[model samples]
Target: MKPADIDEFFRRLAADNPAPKTELEYINPYTLLVAVVLSAQATDIGVNKATGPLFQIVQTPGQMVELGEEKLRQYIRTIGLFNTKAKNVIRLSEILVAEHGGEVPRKRKELEALPGVGRKTANVVLNVAFGQITIAVDTHIFRVSNRTGLARGKTPEEVERKLVRYVPARWKPHAHHWLILHGRYICKARKPDCPACAVRDLCAYPDKTSERDMLEDPPVPVPAG
Candidate 1:
């Protein structure tokens, strides 16, 4: 999209949700990191359901380490890949306690060094927990970016790079939240609600779906600007 359109896209999103926040619940950076890790391949609502009681007991790395793998598994057993996630959580908590004095690290590299914490996880931690201008490209953000022609790329990293470059500085800090929420609620995967979309006019998706998308033969093509 052109620079002006890109700015307008975010402007509408921002206006609709002036203070967008992660749907995942957390008390602190450590819990936030753990929530993001658990959120991999799982929904935010699902992760929150498991983490709600867990966070109350384990707020810091030391506390999480004390929770132990077996017990942690019991807590998150409802989530997918609970065994592996439990092991990673315990080990990463140990590392954090031993190295970072039980606090979540602000640096991206350090954040990624933790078990189950990849670039996307690190970006989320840096952005939501540390207030950085990083955009973690989840499935939602990736689809939204490509569908809207905002920052099309084959991979999430490529899209992240393009978004970092394309998004205006003023909107960079909140871009991730805006895009993710917009994608989740409006520009959905199976069928986007183009008619209700705030940025429908600015979106460049060739085929824009609406409320009757499920019953329709094909979605209507968006008109040229």
Candidate 2:
């Protein structure tokens, strides 16, 4: 998309949600990191449902470690790959306690060094927890970026680089949240709700679906009586 359209796209999204936030619920940075890790290959609602109970009991890295991998698995078993996620969470918690003094690291390198914490997860932790302007291009952001022509790229890293370079500096901090939410609700994969999209006018996608198109015909007018 053009630079002007890019700015307008974000402008509308920001206007709709002045204070966008991560859908994954968490009480603190430690819980945020764990929630993001468990969110891999799972929906935010699913992750939130599992983490809700888990976070109430385990806030700190030490507390998570005490919960143990097996017990953690029980809490998150509803999510995909729970066994692996549990193991990684437990190992990362151990590292956090031993090296970082039981605190989630602010630096990307340190965050990514932890098991189950890749670049995307590290970016999320840095941005959400540390107030950094990093963009973590998950599937949602990736689809929206490419679909809207805001930042088209083959890989998430490429899209992230484009978004970082193109998105206005003023909107950088919250760009990820805006794009993710838009993709999840509006610009969906199966059928984008183009009629309801705030930035539909600025969107460059050729296959924009409309509510009118989904219906056989316009609704008949109601009688005055």
Candidate 3:
């Protein structure tokens, strides 16, 4: 896509959702950190299903530590890789309590230092929890990027770099959310609902749904004499 088109693409996205937010439900930075970690390879609905009850009980690193790995598994067992995620959450929580004084770290290096918190998770935490202009290239965003030719790349890191460079400064903050939501609801992996997509005309995908048949209205009946 051209630079101007990129700007307009984001303009439309931002206009539609002025204040985009992560789908993962959390009360604070700590919970948001843990939720993003758990959300890896899992759907937001799946993560929320587990975290809804888990957060009510474990709001802090201390609570997570006290919950123990065995108990932690019970809370997040529904998500994929529950065993690994449970262990990492426990480990990271302990680090937060001991190293960061129980507060989620705002810096990417500090966040990535935590177990199970990778570049993607760190980006999400920085963007959503700390209000930074970072984009976490998840599967949804990755697909959208390549499919729309918005930021074509073979890897997440490459896609992230392109997105940061191509996206307008004003829209960088919410770019991740917009792309993710668009891919999830409209430009899906299977049959995309291009006809309903807000940016379908602006999209570069050649296989997008045809807009030709969608007429505005039939000819109005002649007025009675």
Candidate 4:
């Protein structure tokens, strides 16, 4: 997409969701960090399902340490890779209590230093937990950026770099949420709902679904994010 179209693309997305937020539910920054770590290979829906009750009980790092790894496994057993995820959650919580005075670290390097927390997870925490402009290119953001010709790249880091460089300053704060939500509901991986896409005309994707398919198959009701 051209610079003008890129700006307009984000303009439409911003209009659709003036206050976009992460689908992951959490009580505080610590819980948000844990939720993002758990959501790595799993869907937000799945992570939220597991974290719903867990967050109520373990809202802080010290509480999580009290819960312990073996018990944490029971809470998140339904999520994929629960065993490893449980261990990481417990260990990271322990580290937070020991190193950060029981608070989630704001620095990217400090966030990434925790177990199960990578650059993407750190970016999510920074963007969602705090008011940061960083965009974490998950599968959704990666596909949407490339598909719409907004910021094409072979890797997530490359796409994030391009988006950071190209996205206008005004839209930077919520760009991550807009792109991720658009990819999830409209520009889907298997069959994008181009007929209902607000930025369809601005999109450069060649394989956009036909209007006829909209009538024949019909679009499912998109759940509220």
Candidate 4 differs from the real structure by a C-alpha RMSD in angstroms, to one decimal, of 1.3
Clashing pairs in 3: none
| Candidate 1, 58-115: lDDT as tens digits | 8988888888999999899989999999999999999998999888999998998999
| Candidate 4: segments with Cα more than 4 A from true spot | 215-217, 220-225
| lDDT winner | 4
Overall local distance difference test of candidate 4: 0.90
Which is superior by TM-score, 2 or 3?
2
Worst 10 residues of 1 by lDDT: 216-225
Sort order, lDDT high to low: 4, 1, 2, 3
- Every candidate's CA RMSD: 4.7, 5.5, 7.3, 1.3
**Per-model lDDT:** 0.90, 0.89, 0.88, 0.90
Winner on TM-score between 1 and 3 is 1
Residue 170's lDDT within candidate 1 is 95
For model 2, residues 112-149, the per-residue Cα lDDT tens digits are 89999999999998999999999999999999998888
lDDT of 4 by residue, 1-225 (tens): 788888998898887778888989999999999999999889999999999989888999999999999989998998999999999999999999999999998899999999999989999999988888799999999999999899999999999999999999999999999888888888888888999999999888998898887676666544544
